[model samples]
Target: MKLKLNQLDILLEVAAQGSIGKAAKALNLTQPAISKTIQEMEAEIGLPILQRSSRGVTLNEYGQVLLRHARDIDRSLHQAREEIDHLLGKAMRQLRVGFTSAASYGPFTNTMIEFQARYPGVKLVAMEGRPHQILDALQNQRLDIAVLTAGTSIVQSGMYYEPLYALSNTIIAGDQHPITHTTSLKSLMNYPWLDWDEPGEHSILAQVFRRYNLPQPQNIVHCSSPWVMARMMEQADMVSMWTSVRLRFPGYNVNLRPLALREVLPATSIGVLCPNIGRLSTAGNTFLEMLRINARDWLQQSDAAEMVARV
Candidate 1:
């Protein structure tokens, strides 16, 4: 290709920072040198890639196209380095994995435990975040794999989502809550509710109330931290949505119990999202296999009603 990797690097930096001088400083190159690289690239391409302005430079259509491939090339080059190092016995295999908050309730940690016991040399880095955040990390080459629910989720190009299992969620409350005794959508809404603070997630609780033609609850508490929510559930009359497998994870107290309501949340797909199976590193592929195997067992053992209590 006419555009060298270093030139593409400069272009990407300039696009991100929006200033040639900033890009030059970041790349440890002189301002004129950065300009010369762009000039050379434009000379070869026979068109301008950036729109020069007094404030800063931005990528034009041509520049955006080049940047898309540039990022891909950069990630592929990184994978190639890791592959070469592993083959040379210079570095141990590493797997970077991420999961959404809902997926944390699944058997991800158990699978990781078994995988680590089996492959002592493979390194694992795990992260938990929202679905969009996980997908962003995967697309930015920060994470090798991500497991999340496929419900009104973002779908990016060049990324593949493999459905692993069907997942469900439900509302949970402390045993002290009055709604626990007399469970009704109206009665459940009477008390303050706690839920995830993720804006991208579908408001299943709100949707359920709306489906019943009831006014939306006014007393709602949104929490981003599951630990904080659990604490609140133990201390106060708070209700929140939780996956059936949530009981498998730690930090939950005996005070919490699932509310048997006639209305249940919609089901979603629990699956693995990654770049490409063929491009996955040795450890990455192995971890993906572990997820698949564990997901099958989890789905088979999980009772449908326990996860999603539909009337």
Candidate 2:
């Protein structure tokens, strides 16, 4: 039984996203198309390879075994293509970058600005989405890399990552909030809260809340955009937990304070992840290098200084 590589790619995507609908969106194929393709592959294999569950997509034993060989095939094919491109004297000039909104506002922007300064000739295609969307794009070959919260669930073979910066979780309330100086958890639980829980777009504050064994804040509003979040913040008495990196942008009338929980929030690093390392272009490689250097030299140092002052 011979399975097509495209079918394998689709399977990997569905497995990563845990949703056929999202995989279809990333592949520019309809749900029926993706499902049929996977079904066709399963037919050829003469066994059930994948399964769906509330927890997300998971691979059966055969699927896991096949995934390893399928990834090797992908890597070999990628290496062959890279070799041919190199022989043709081709260098990458067009790059597709994906990031979450917070990443774009933070060091992800800085990394791109620095790359542009060095490789001004490279054409950049930038796409933004919540974390899962970005991962889907990367998996579907729509993007070469994505900036997202580190230690995500988008695991696939041959994927590589670079840690860019760490972010602090703080409750961002509007200026109307009466608790400006209050860092105590008891004080913070008094107000309304906001959260963003799009697929794979987990917030650092969620972990903080869990660590303290605290209940969800009393009142709550949900937002998907920084701008919308900002607007809501201005118009209502909402206190949402957000990353310091995001709040650093423009005017978001937020009163940021460290709520004295049982322990400090375990900061999540924002990482630039190449969902496919086997296919990195030369320009992408260069951009990755510059990102690493900037993270080490500039972003981390500045963030450290800012942290010392805040603490």
Clashes of each: 0, 2
- Which runs of model 1 end up more than 4 angstroms from their true locations? 1-92, 155-158, 198-215, 251-253, 302-311
- lDDT (tens digit, per residue) of candidate 1 on 40-103: 9889888898898899999899989988999999899999998786784522367788987667
List, residue by residue over 196-221, the lDDT tens digit for candidate 2: 76322365455566668876565656
Top of the candidates by lDDT? 1
Give RMSD (Å) of candidate 2 vs. truth: 17.6
Candidate 1: the clashing residue pairs are: none
Query: TM-score of predicted model 2?
Result: 0.62
Off by over 4 Å in 2: 1-91, 154-158, 198-204, 253-263, 307-311
